[model samples]
Target: MSDAVQASGAPAPVGHYPHARRVGQLLFLSGIGPRDPASNAIVGNVHDADGHLISYDIDAQCRAVFANVRAVLQASGARWEDLVDVTVYLTDMARDFKAYNRVWAECFPDASRAPCRTTLGINALPTPIAIELKCVAEIKSPLPLAGEG
Candidate 1:
């Protein structure tokens, strides 16, 4: 049976779903954004007087989103090196791609160790965040249930 993972250290999911799900050796993470866990605030977002998004810092968002992904991976008993694939979504590809790529290289410094990635330019997200990541990891060990050690 598959198990759902809810990371207490990560922001609560925007919808009813858990942060991730594990089926066999694979852990699939939901779309992870740059929302802070304690405040639920969008990182790097610059809003206008009426709270509309004016701009964002893609580098900060990328770091935060990667941190969120790491939290989900840890909660699922996986590791950063276990990530097999990642799908990135950006609201403004033309403006953010270079900064995003720079942060990505920092996170995955070694080309041989980096996960397979696909980045897409999207119109919007559930929130005003500029970027999000969907990730898949190969778990080397079985994840314990909520009650068991």
Candidate 2:
């Protein structure tokens, strides 16, 4: 059986979806972006009065996206080291790939423990964020039942 997870520490999903869903020993995270949980603001995004895209800091977005992903993982009773795979989406690969990679290296310092990754350049996202992550993690231990100490 599968169970859905919602992270209180992460931004509310823009549409009808939970943060992650767990089936058996694997947890599958939805596309997580760099929006703040409390404010729902897209980190590193700047817009004009008309809501036109102006500029963004890819590094900041990358860091925030990782944090968001971690929140989902934590809520799902998983760990960073439990991540098995990640798919990254970037709005501007040419301008942001290097900066994103730098932040990625900071989060995952050890290659052996890092999960498999695939990064893609996309035209745009549902939000104004520059980066998003879709992750899959393995739950190392079975979670305790509710009310069980």
Candidate 3:
């Protein structure tokens, strides 16, 4: 049954797809954008890249994106505290970079102990949402090592 979902507390996948997957003691999560998992769409279109679409608000997107990430962690039995490393991708650095770090600090427990992170700007992404986060986490479990006899 555990192989089925022992880690889950009968939690559903964030979508038809999983927000995260656990192999051994590691969890790999997809980017959590600013959207309610139930809704599957960002509250509104985010026009982040060079004013491509219409909206260009960074704060709102950061909040929502982080929230989505939380949901994923919960579903996978991991948490921000469990995170070992994170990768963030964005489109515009000048306009949103400073604000992004500020939001991240507010969203997490402490920056000093925060997971190793990388932030970079790209020309394009799946949506206009200003920030996307992917995480890797470790959950301690008792299992025999391959070399164990």
Candidate 4:
């Protein structure tokens, strides 16, 4: 196997870029958005920041991002608890930070023992998306089944 597998459960593969890649024990996931992996519909956030079809709910967005993260981990045969690091990018840091933290706390409690994280404020993001999250994880090798021998 290419020492890894590409995770593709999102609404759509926005571009040619692969959703995730695995090299030996390490798995790297791309930025995640709040949308239905199948329909590509933005989740939660009902009203757009400037009032448009493209919108995002803070909690929903967080969940969607994590959902995508979870999918990638599973595709690589990994798990959320296996995550070692994460990076987040936001359009408006001041406006969304508080809400983001609320959701973050729920998603990653005791992050100190979870994984290293860094959030940054950006000018904008992909169409209809406000926040994106990426992460790194270590996939554990699977042992033989209980009675495979």
What lDDT does each candidate get?
A: 0.92, 0.91, 0.68, 0.76
Give each model's clash number.
0, 0, 0, 5
- Per-residue lDDT tens digits of candidate 3, residues 11-116? 2344466556678788787666676555556655655579556765678778877776666666565666888898988878888899898988886767788889
Using lDDT as the measure, the top candidate is 1
Return the top candidate by TM-score: 1
**Local accuracy of candidate 2 as per-residue lDDT tens digits, 103-149:** 88888999888899999999999878888899999999876687752
Model 2 clash number: 0
What does candidate 4 score on TM?
0.82
- Estimate, for each residue in 1-149, the C-alpha lDDT of model 1 and write its tens digit: 69899999899999999999999899999999999998999999899999888888888899999999988898889999999999999998999999999999998899899999999999999988999999999999887766975
- Residue range 7-119, candidate 4, lDDT tens digits: 67665557676777777778788777777887777787676577766545677777888888788777667888889988989887888888888888887788677788899
Please, what is the TM-score per model?
0.95, 0.94, 0.74, 0.82
* Model 2 regions lying over 4 Å from their true place: 147-149
Q: What is the C-alpha RMSD of each candidate to the true structure, in Å?
A: 1.2, 1.4, 7.1, 4.1
Judge candidate 4 against the unseen true structure and give its global Cα lDDT, from 0 to 1.
Answer: 0.76
Q: Model 1 has how many clashing residue pairs?
A: 0
Give the better candidate number (1 or 2) by TM-score: 1
